[model samples]
Target: MHDSEDLVVVVDGELLTNTETICTGMKAQHASTMKLLRKHLKQLQTFGEVRFEIRLNPQGSDTEYAMLNEQQSALLISLMRNRKEVVSFKVKLIREFFRMRDALGQRDMTLWRQLQVAIAQEVDSAVRASFGSRLMLDRKKDKPILQSEIHRLESEIQPGLLLN
Candidate 1:
């Protein structure tokens, strides 16, 4: 495997790995892995549909590979014998899924934060438009924050986040 290749990829917004990857990591034959998948195909389908893709091998032959979601992949690995390499690969696969999940969560939070800022800006714009005569604050004198400023500040106060 190449150092830059992703262990898991998002397909239809879900992380997935292919039998080819599993076989490579476990040092198992691709045909045997495909056979195992076919044998338990029904059970695997319970998690999600197993999409098969055909690719041209270096030898100018076509080969089929199954793309399995996290649950299906786990189940398939569990059905395989616990060879040392398989076990090691299983652990690596688990960590890859975990890392992907964490990354997605972080991305979601960032999008949420961005939405908050966008909404806040809209609200602040409305407040500014509503109060044309709104007085500006003087640093030396005591003055209250404008409604627009309040809305802008509120956007910065995300839940569980430290404010600077």
Candidate 2:
């Protein structure tokens, strides 16, 4: 693998195979693109770490019905070069989502949780469709975080500390 070439995973693309290699410039540019992709998909909160691999005679039997030809594959890589831009946008969106949830209070909690579940389902489906592999849902099996602690943390943190 050349320094410029790397594995890339996209929400709506093939699994990483051995033959796929993204160039350095392309990688740099795709950072933003990936971020944006994530931002849109994050609405589902179902997105997980995307895996990128390149291989010859790509596994045809895998799920996701991947039909990427060389040209299509190359185009996807080229477009992903600006990943950070997408990420920036996604961060903003996430914050907004949180803000909305918080401001809406308990009234919105049920709806928000439901939305989260739907997003998870979509991501699970997408992953299976792409890789034909069973997707894992990270269940928050642990105990719920206590509300008092939440308030304490929020109050204890000084405004200046946040920037650091």
lDDT (CA) per prediction: 0.75, 0.36
Query: What would the TM-scores of all predictions be?
Result: 0.75, 0.18
User: After best superposition, candidate 2 residue 6: deviation in angstroms?
Assistant: 36
Question: What TM-score does candidate 1 get on C-alpha atoms?
Answer: 0.75
**Tens-place lDDT digits, model 2, residues 1-164:** 23211232222222231122332223343334444434543332232333344333344533221222233333444444347654443333334434443544553455455545555555555555555333322222111223333333333332234422
Report each candidate's C-alpha RMSD, comma-separated, in the order given: 8.7, 20.9
Q: For this target, which candidate reaches the highest TM-score against the unseen true structure?
A: 1
Q: In model 1, how large is the Cα lDDT of residue 69?
A: 93
Which window of ten consecutive residues has the lowest lDDT sum in model 2? 136-145
Worst 10 residues of 1 by lDDT: 135-144
